[model samples]
Target: MIKALIIDDEPLARDIIKSYLKDNIDLKVLAECSNGFEGVKAINDLKPDLVFLDIQMPKINGFEMLEMIDEPPHIIFSTAFDNFALKAFEANAADYLLKPYSKERFLEALEKATQKINSNAPIATQKIIKDHQESVEILDRIVVRFGNKIHIIGLETIRYIQAQDDYVDIYTHEGKYLKQITMKYLEAHLPTDKFVRTHRSFIVNIEFIDKIEVYDKESYVLHLKEGQKISVSRSGYSRLKEVLSF
Candidate 1:
């Protein structure tokens, strides 16, 4: 039997999917989750073969939850929004089921998922996540996963960000957390008024800046309020000067 999980914030939506699946003896409903937090826990614990995922959920969105997983199951996205259709396909989702869809559409998506599963196809999602991140005009917060725990860091609390190979280290007053993301994406998404890419490897929050010291004729160093110093390149200094107007 094909084990599946339904993750949606609405109770009615879950009920509808369940109702449609009653006749599909080949598939089994493993669990139902109301929010992304429960969805993450269920997905990790149950390890379902297929997931009916909703894009917008409490705590974290579906895309953010997917990032936390090492190997995500074949996904059939079910959401009210049509704007995410391109992104869902970019992620190579099994199918995109718009809300209020008929049972026939659900079955069609299920058939596609079954074929992929039987063929042992892998889900490639990195590009889609990157695409989704870039589509956002501004970032108010970031989600990071450590073991089984998930942390949501607001932009206001972020002291700085440092690139570490393919991952980036996000530093806040509370602590530092490593996330698998690109600095370029963050540089483009983060609020320009509050954050500045002070160097190729560093992006600093202006509120955290204590002082700026001239390291040389072409470069400088930033002293944050927490006493951590960051190196600034000539181009970075120019950008900083434009933002700080100094």
Candidate 2:
């Protein structure tokens, strides 16, 4: 049987989804969540195979919530917004069901999700997050969950980003925090004028730069406040020079 989770802020919407799933004997509704924070906890605890997710929720939206999870379930997005449909599909969502959709449409989406789940296909969550980042408006803050606590890191507070396999480490005045995201995604969304990729694995906030020093003929290093240093590749150094005009 396919274990399912419903994550929608509206009580009516959650009930509607539950009603639609009643006919599908192969799927079982395991939990219902009103907001993204609750959804995250439910997903982590329940480990459901499929999720009916709503985009706009309190505290953090659907996309931000997904970023917190290392492995997200097969997601069928139900949202009133149409602008995110193309990006959602590109991110490999199991399906996208616009709000006020008919039962027939919901069945169709369910069927699609069921087929993928039965075949044991991996959900393209990372790709989906990256695609969503590129399509959406510039984010002013990043929402992350550390244990049971949710933290919102303002963009201005970020000092640098370092790549860590499938994740990235966000550094600030307070400390470093891990986020399951990619360099390409960060580069696409972050403001170009303020942050620059100074190496294959490092993107630094130019606002915190104290100086740029020569490491050798082909290499350079960035000096920041508190005596912190970051290596700068030849290409990265060139890009930094072009952006900083120095």
Candidate 3:
């Protein structure tokens, strides 16, 4: 079972989250706290595997309490507000439940957290997820139209993306496609450590890159390990190199 804690200033919010977890066989609602101070104590003592945190509270804030613990459990921000999407992701938060959230949304967050915990890959991905979450301007895994209906495409699958007129064309190892969102907005939402701009219109996934080739005298090009080539401008190439540590 996934041990869990709920730390929120509002009693109703905490109770609601606990009630949502009632039918979840995989999660154990270890404890609940009404303030950040008590939360710090409960979390330290229980060392729960997960926490549903609220960003605002009296005394210490969620972010401040987060800094107090070592190896903090996976966190899911639970509150009524939705404006903190970017900051919440930048912190590598597991998930967020807006106020008056449904049982389904809470279940979705629980499943997402469980997947990360059970994956065979090293725990480093969790750290990366957290770090990148803190910086994401837009939330990842948005719903999009595939053909007739909507499908969820995780932003992480995109190996490289370029803007096409008003649309952004996304490329992945599996394939490439178009989306309605502007590249400007995508740049803000993508994790800094995962993706970098290599050209004015191009963003490349660092993990998919094979090598960087210096071009004539003007710029460089990244040959993604996937065998796709993307041009990199002077400043953009430098920024890529710095971000990817190449």
State which candidate has the highest TM-score.
Answer: 1
lDDT of 2 by residue, 1-246 (tens): 999999999999999998888778899999999999888889999999989999998878898888878788888888898575467575564478889999999999888889888998777766776677777766678887766877789889999999999889999888888887789878877888888999999999999999999999999999998678999999999989988998
Question: Model 3: what TM-score?
Answer: 0.48
Q: What is the C-alpha lDDT of each candidate?
A: 0.87, 0.86, 0.72
Ranking by TM-score: 1, 2, 3
Q: Which ten residues in a row have the lowest lDDT in candidate 1?
A: 85-94
All models, RMSD in angstroms: 1.7, 2.8, 15.6
Worst 10 residues of 2 by lDDT: 85-94
Candidate 3, which segments miss by more than 4 Å at Cα? 82-85, 90-94, 120-246
Off by over 4 Å in 2: 22-26, 90-93, 119-127, 134-139
**Model 2 local distance difference test score:** 0.86
Q: What tens digits encode model 1's per-residue C-alpha lDDT throughout 1-246?
A: 889999999999999999999998999999999988888899899999999988889878998888888777888888798475466465554478888899999888889889888888776455566567766778888999876799889889999999999999999988899999888889988989999999999999999999999999989999999899999999999999999999
Candidate 3 backbone clash number: 10
Give the lDDT of residue 112 in candidate 3. 81
Task: For model 3, name the residue pairs that clash.
Answer: 80-99, 89-133, 89-134, 90-133, 90-134, 90-135, 91-133, 91-134, 92-130, 210-225
